[model samples]
Target: MEKERGYNMQIPEIQITKSWRKSISMSFDTQGVLQVRAPKFMLSGQIDNFLLKNSAWIDKNFQKITQRIKNKKKYLLWRELQNLETISDLEQYFKQEAKKYIIPRCNELAQKYWFTHAWIRITSAATRWGSCSSKKTLNFSYRLVMSPVECIDYVIIHELCHLRQMNHSTKFWKEVFSIMPSYKIYENHLKNEGWKYTL
Candidate 1:
């Protein structure tokens, strides 16, 4: 069964593309890379797997992307599972133990940028970092506590910007860049390491 996601974490998902006739292998790298083994005929792109930033073609065929990822296995190693206690320090930390360090930074940046966030919720879903609804409620995945702090900040700022602009229109990105000039770098960094956890 899938583990429960904590209030501040989300699992990172990766896209895998292969011929409908071929089988593929999806695995994470030690440095936290999302690797998809497939036939060359079907090329794959590693993205945040949350919302694709470039949506010209994606928006029209969104399901096409979402439907392709491999499903999570019914069971996982206790150590690989996301929770409060680490397998190593099974005695001391929870899988999402890292969130304690992330939420405050998110709030600080949101306040710094003038977002009227009603509350910050943390979770451990492997597919998303942060999300903002029209209600002004923010939801974050605890998996982020494992990522670099810069990446954590980027997701927070990205979602927080959504409070002002809900879509990825040029203006929305402008807001993201206003607060994070190196947003792209951190985005790539997240993509590079984000898919280790299965959602």
Candidate 2:
């Protein structure tokens, strides 16, 4: 009877025009909106009843989905700032802030969306802005310090999201986008400034 919070349930009612010769699947999204995969001959009323019968499961899975998004973890990784004497003190400071601020912010964002995972980390990576290993260790590039706080958070959260998802599937992006609507802007910011940097 109560509506779900923290998630929008705008599931466009799907109209089936195609035929399926096999069995079908059905479920609701994390937001508690129902979705049914049915054959062309299946009655809409039956689908509706099926959804009604599974309301409790729908609610539970929806919460689970939200947790899967918000509970993502970050893994910090970076040994001593090694023999790159060519790097300036200011650059080193930036790298340090990147490690510090990025990790906490990512953790907060993960909680907001209901994602939980094992670890978080920061690193001096060149090509990769961030990475989420299968082991759940999140790796963020030290170069994130070069960008604004918003851009850095975007990258950090993006990597943290990979803890729940391994690929760039629609669901993965959905989880990422749900957490940071402004994520796209940060992505563009990275691209524009990417050429300016030596890396």
Candidate 3:
């Protein structure tokens, strides 16, 4: 791991790993440290050049991660002040919010759109907002309650559309668009801001 700050921008420590790979790739770890994987025989100069070339991309993502860290700290402080310290406490609260808000909203949309589902289940899923099973069961992440209402509806309608079309084919998106013409804005909102919807 090299700690030298060669790039002009102020970035986190760069850790380089030499491997038997053909290319150089870089990404940030959970702590916002930049991790680079390069070919074993790659020279230091080559790696520096790679970093320089991708400085803008690195800076953008680093700022985003920094904001996320700050937001998480604020959330923790608020939780501590509110005495909601335990994971179970947060989970229970999220589940209650999901059931009270998401379930009824899902039912309303289904009825309005003439969509049917076998059931709805709330989960602790972190990677995805919602999914639809082949048996017409819809599973949503309890974390989704933290997102904006429009994003929440987008996820609900997205999974509901899957109840009609199992795949993300053109027809599936068509169904989603038919119900919510502005679905892409909500989808992009989730893609950009959904990371904050965490415990």
| Model 2, runs deviating above 4 Å | 1-91, 197-199
Per-residue error for 138 in candidate 1, Å, reads 0.9
Question: How much lDDT does each candidate structure score?
Answer: 0.64, 0.67, 0.90
Q: Identify the superior model by TM-score, candidate 1 or candidate 3.
A: 3
Candidate 3 per-residue lDDT over residues 1-199, each given as its tens digit: 9776856666678899999999999999888899999999999999999999998899899988878788778767876786777556788898988989999999999999999998999999989999999999999999899888999999999999998899999999999999999999999988877877787
* Least accurate 10 contiguous residues by lDDT in model 2: 71-80
Model 3 TM-score on a 0 to 1 scale: 0.69
Q: In what order do the candidates fall by lDDT, top score first?
A: 3, 2, 1
Greater lDDT among 1 and 3 belongs to 3
**Residue-wise C-alpha lDDT for candidate 1, range 1-199, written one tens digit per residue:** 9876555432344455554545555554432334555655544343333234533333333343332332122123433565423355532243345447666787788778888888777765667777888998888877776566788889999999989999999999999999999999989967755764333
Please give the RMSD to the true structure for each candidate, in Å.
Answer: 15.9, 17.6, 6.3
Task: Report the error of model 2 at residue 38, Å.
Answer: 67
What TM-score would you give candidate 2 relative to the actual structure? 0.51
Question: Per-residue alpha-carbon lDDT of model 2 for 54-159, expressed as tens digits?
Answer: 7676667766555543422111112124334445674676578776787788788778777775677777777878898888778887777656788877887787
Per-prediction tally of clashes: 30, 20, 0
Ranking by TM-score: 3, 1, 2
